[model samples]
Target chain A: MIELLLILCIVAAIIAIESKNLLSSIISLGGVGFSLAIIMLFLSAPDVAFVQILVEVVMLIILIRATINRDVTEVKCKREFFGMIFGMALVTVLLGILLMGIQTLPEFGTALVNASAESVPAKYYIENGLAQTGSANIVTGVLLDYRAYDTLGEATVLFTAIIGAIAILRKKKTNE
Target chain B: MNILPLFVTIPLAGAFVVSLFDFIKDEKKKNISTNIFASLAGLVLLVISIKVIGSAGVYSMGKWKLPEGIVLVLDPFSGPILLITNLISFICILFSFDYMSGYNGREKYYSLFFLMVAGMNGLVLTGDIFNLYVFLEIASVASYALVGFGTMREEIEATFKYMVLSSVATAFMLLGVAFIYGFTFNLNMVSVAKALGSMEAPVGVYVALGLFIIGFSIKSALIPFHAWLPDAHPSAPAPISAMLSSVVIKTVGMYSLIRICYVVFGMNTGQVPEVLRVLGILSMMLGVLLALGQWDFKRLLAYHSVSQMGYIALGFGLGTPLGVIGGIYHLLNHSVFKSLLFLNSGAVYYRTGTRDLKEMGGLGKKMPVTGATSMIASMSIAGIPPFNGFWSKLIIIMACIKSSHPWLAFWAVLGSILTLASFLKVQRYGFLGKVKDSLRNVKEAPFMMQVSMITLALLCLAMGGLMLPGLYDLIFVPAAGIILDQAQYLKLVLGN
Candidate 1:
């Protein structure tokens, strides 16, 4: 089932990448996101999937708004050969990096831990997270209680992004 | 006292509040209120930072133990950096009183400036690796917007280029943090360091370190990764340029690199210092060499920033006590003179409305204050004796030779001479030659601008006093000790 969902993701991703029309490309990107959200649901991460779908819906609206009235079908730049070569190079480099990364990760569900290690933090999180944070959801416990500082930092990053967008897009004096 | 969060909080709150002033219907009233309020916020941070200097402790957020929640650490090492960060930030806000007024959305400029400050302060103070990455993004994002604040074609283009490259660096950093988390299941740096030290780290750990070094090298604008800086720095409004070139790169780039390499990974990480040395030498030679040909004054100074970060890198690259001292010393001195130089260029542009060196001439007579300050900054950056730059460069070169990397010392000397020549061009062409017919009516910068320049110029001279044992022992020596002694740092944070 996971394999089927992942293959769907791949197909949509490819469609998105290959689409000539901007609207179709964006829609295909939405296809990839919706399938990934479904995959998250199957993987027992409902909260992430729910957030994913919400974000996907909003992103689709914004992107579609950006593309609707534009010359969606016209190809702007004539760089097919160069683009193809660069894309191929990027794929090769990414594959190399993936292989290198895979070598360091543990086999499937087992913990990525030193085999000789006595302990890991997950054990404490599982046993005490409920009592300590009073949240039945361990993910919430982790994000909001134990690692709340990171959550605040992430929020600040978003704030910075909003201000940055406004700063860049604000109306300038007419002299220019 | 758990005052660490204030370093991040005060400026962030200041940003939020200052942004509110955008709605004020009265133009002059709004400008006066926002600028005064921002400067006061900056002054408060400066006062608190000065009060907090030389103080060392770790404060865990929410009273949570290390390895469980976030922590902020201030030690002998981070103290002076913290001081300088606030000091320069306040001065930049003071300088921007007039400089940023020409642009629209002056309220947003002050807001973004505070955000950048908050980000850098949080970055320098945070003890968790992931938290550091978050703060890194905050600072980088703010800087990107600030760089393009003017909305001119070149400003937007520079911002886009900067944003793209900086995003790449951010990806590298996040991946590095992820790799570390996978290895240790820890986000707190002390815990990660402890875990890795005990485990006999694998290839992945080294890979993570490599990623971090590369990411930071790009941030620091080392030679090969430095295409964005000359454009971004010169395109920014003058105060933002001063902030970016002075504290932003050092705090977010070089400081992070040093912390990860020395305190977290330790010498056993292998090849870290050597990599730093090679990169340092390259940035030093190539940056100065690159600067020699630029006709724009600010662009030339921006290139010099890249070169001088090389000097700091070389100082730390040696892994000697004296080397660390030299690195910290140079870091302090560069912030002083470089910002002064940028403000000088800003004044020139403010008066004559051009950055072309060929367009400038001996309006040194018209703008004596700017001319004199630029001269002092030029001399200091060129390593003239009795100035702060001379002491730091002398220490760096001495350390290079003392470390028995005599060839590196030779390259260091050559970089300095090239730097001297480059600034000579800046002085001779931009200020000292016969007054140009076009610029004859140009006047000096405004009162506040002169105050900023004169204040920084005074700092450039007074920073030489830092070499005296009194101040040296008080600041740089112990700062170097914290950087050099990994065990003490871990102990300081973790209370081993």
Candidate 2:
């Protein structure tokens, strides 16, 4: 089942990248996101799946808005043959290196330990997260209490994006 | 008392307040209120940073232990960077008081500026790798908007390019973080270091390191990944340009790269330093070569930023004690003088409504302050003796020769000479020649702008004093020491 979902994701991603029509590409991208979220759900990460779905929806809307009334169908595929070859070679080398590195990882779902031979932080968080943060949802507890600084930074990113959009899109006032 | 959280919180709260000022119908009230709040916030940060110097501790959130909660670490390494970040930010905000008035949306501008500042401060102080990424994105996103704030064709185009490239870099960084977490089961820097230190690095770890290096190299605007900087830096408003060129790249790029390479991966004597050295040389030679041909005043400075960053990278990549000191010192000096140069260019833009050096000349008589400050900055950056740049460059070159890499030292000297030539062009064509008719009536920058520029210029002069043993021990020595001894960081953050 995971293999099927993974293949679906790959197909959708390829379709999204290769589709000439902007709208179709966006829909294909949405397909990829939906499949990925399902995969997350299967992995027993409902919170991640939920966030992924919501983000996918928002992204689709944004892509739609950006593409609306635009002649993006003209999609110029200017292939620089040398550049393409170089890119392919680089990707191949990177993947080769990455594959070699992956061999050293511990087998999947194994109990991981720190250098001190103690259980990793995840074990501690799982056992004590609720008591420490007073939140029922461990994810929320972790995000808001245990790691609220990261949340603050995330909020700042969102705020910056909004302000940046407004700063860029606002019509200039001439009274000054 | 845990004052660490305030470093992230105060600027964030200031950003929120500045955003609220958008409701004010009166422009004067809005402007004055936002400026005061932002500057006050900056002043508070500066004070806190100064107080935190020479102190190293970890502040875990919600009273949770380090292994269970996100922590903010204030080691000797983070100390100097934090100080530089806040000090430059405060001065930039003060400078922008008069400089930013020409642009629209002053309220949103200050809001985004503070947001960027918060992100950078958090990035500098955070002990978790994932937390660093979050803050990195915050700062990068804000800068993207700031770059395109003008809404002009070039500004929008540059912002779009910067956004795409930077987002790709961030994505790579996230993947690298995931790789580390998958293997080590740890997200905190100290924990990750502790984990990796115990065992031989596997393939996954190497891949993760590669991703991090590429991501950070892109962020730092090192050669081959630096195409976005020339376009993005020159298109933004002057203060934003100064901040981006001076603090943003260093904090997000070089600082993080150094932290990961030295602390987490522990590449003290290996292939990593050699890669860094090669990249550094490439950036230094290529950056200046590219810079020598630029005609736009700000664009020229932007290219020079890449070149100067090369020097910093080379200094650190030498993997020697003196090299690290030189790198850290050069980072500080570059922030002072490079921002001064950009601000000088902005002053020229403000007065004559042009950034084309070929179009203006003989402005020395009209704007003595800008001219004098620009000259100081130019000399400092060109590695003239008695200036801050000279001392740092000398140390770096000496470190290079000592490390048995005389070729790198020679490249360093050549880069400096080319830098001098480029600035001489700036001085000759932009400030010293016959004044064009349109620029004849141009006046000096406003009082606040002059104050900031002169303050930074004095900083450039005074920073030379940092080379003295007394101040060196106080500032760069600790930072360099931290880089040299990663075990100290691990012990400090996660006590044995």
Candidate 3:
């Protein structure tokens, strides 16, 4: 069941990327998110499903709002056939690799995080995270306690993006 | 407090403090304080980097154990890079003092500059692959903003193009990092190196390595992935052009690529060096060929950046002790001279308000300082005797011959000769002829700009000394040693 949903997600994502028109691409992207949420729920991860649904809905609405009263038609360019063929070839190669990787994984529902899986990092985190960090949630302990520096870097990246938007979008002249 | 974190923290705090001054109503006051803070931050980082040379340590973040947490390692490899990034960035700040007077929002400029510095500092220092990606984004995004900071139509267009390509590269890098994690289940470079050494790696790991190479090649503006650099470098303000062309590409692009290939994946006995050599020679020839036709001063230099990076790559491709040393020595030399050349161009632009080669002639007589410094720069770039560019190029060429790839040596020498021809064009037509009517009244660049140029020019002369036996052992040997031996790096980071 999860494999079917994941395939659906990949197909929708491909459509989202390959679509020329903005509106179709946006809808295809929504298809990806919705199927992903379904897969999450099926995998017994309702918390992730809930968050994904909420975020996907909000994102789709925002994209639709931005698309209103604008031309969804893409500007056609010359030599697009070769470009499309090239892009398709790349996608096919990447997807082939993805499928190969998937074939080698453990059983679909096996919990690597909690399983006694030969001393993987995730298993170590699951076992010792609560004891060392004093957090009941392993995710919180890993994110905030162990790899908080990465969170700092992530926050800085966000801050830089905001600065970029401001720098790019600012008015030419300031009010005296 | 170990000094590793301060390399990043100083710049981050400085950027924030500079941005806070944006609220100041008086432009002059705001500019003064921001510039002062940015310069001081650069100075402090430079001093600390200098102090840490030849020292190695691992600073674990949040006091967590090695495998579970983030670590910033300062070894012989990263210490010099930290020095160059800070040193060149410090000079750029000085150059911007006068050059940016015409532009508005000095506060925004300095803030973004420091942020870019902070990002690069973290990128160079971090041992975790995922953290490297995060910091790479910070540096890249800040650079995109800086590229378009002028908000001119051309600048904005170039920024958009550069941003698109670089975003793609960063995505490739992140995907590559994900693959590394999946295969080895390790984030730390030392640990990942250990894991990959023990395990029989799958096909996916090689693909991930391919992805990593492509990502960094794009960042460094190698031959095939080099379209955005010519546009982006010229479109940026001069100080920024200097930074992007000089240290930014080296740190985020080639440095990451080398670190991953050597420490994590192991470079010996692979087809990787063969591939890099081909790319290097291709970039060398094509970059110079494309540069030979350019009329725009900055664009021509931008193209040569592609060519110079090729030499460094080719040196690495040789995979010998002399080859790697030549690669690294050229890396330092290229950083100084390229930044100087850009500063010279920026100084020219400041005085004359033009970037076209045809618009200016014989201004050398009028603007003696800019003329002289640029002439020094041109000579250094063209590989004249006693100048820094000549030595590195000679070393690289010799390494090629020593490696028995005399054809590669032939190509290196040919590339250097073509480089000379193009720079001679710059000198003859752009600087040394009759001063054009429009440029008649042009004077030397502002004092601050001259200081920056002269400092770099002096570096171009003195760097030849670095090749001497005394400094060679202290600096070049260990850097090459680290790049060659993964075990030494592992022991440095994760001691037995």
DockQ of each: 0.53, 0.63, 0.44
Give candidate 2 regions above 4 Å deviation: A71-83, A111-118, A173-176
- Best candidate per DockQ, number? 2
Give per-model TM-scores: 0.96, 0.97, 0.94
**Pick by lDDT: 1 or 3, better one:** 1
Write model 2 residue lDDT over B354-431, tens digit each, in one string: 899888899887899999999999999999989999999999999999999999999999999999999999999988
Tens-digit lDDT string for candidate 1 (B1-496): 4677899889989998998998998878888999899999999999889988878989888767766778999988788889999999998888888887687787888888998999899889989888999998889999999998888889999999999999999899999998887778888878888888898777778778878988999999987889999999999999889999999999989999998879888862347888888899999999999899999999999999999999999999989989999999999899999999999988888888999998888968889999999999999999998899999999999999987989999999999999999999988988897998988789889999999999999999999999888888989888888888888888888776
The residue-level lDDT of candidate 3 at B371 comes to: 87
| Stretches of candidate 3 exceeding 4 Å from the true structure | A14-21, A38-79, A94-119, A173-176
How are the candidates ranked when ordered by DockQ, highest leading? 2, 1, 3
Tens-digit per-residue lDDT, A1-176, candidate 1: 98998999999999897777778888999999999999999978999999999999999998888778876564466668987999899889856864686578555557633432124555566777898889999989888988887787788788888888888889765133
Worst 10 residues of 1 chain B by lDDT: B264-273
Index of the highest-lDDT prediction: 2
Q: For the second chain of model 1, what is the TM-score against the true structure's chain B? A: 0.99
| Candidate ordering by TM-score (highest first) | 2, 1, 3
Could you tell me which 10 consecutive residues in candidate 3 chain B have the lowest summed lDDT?
A: B261-270
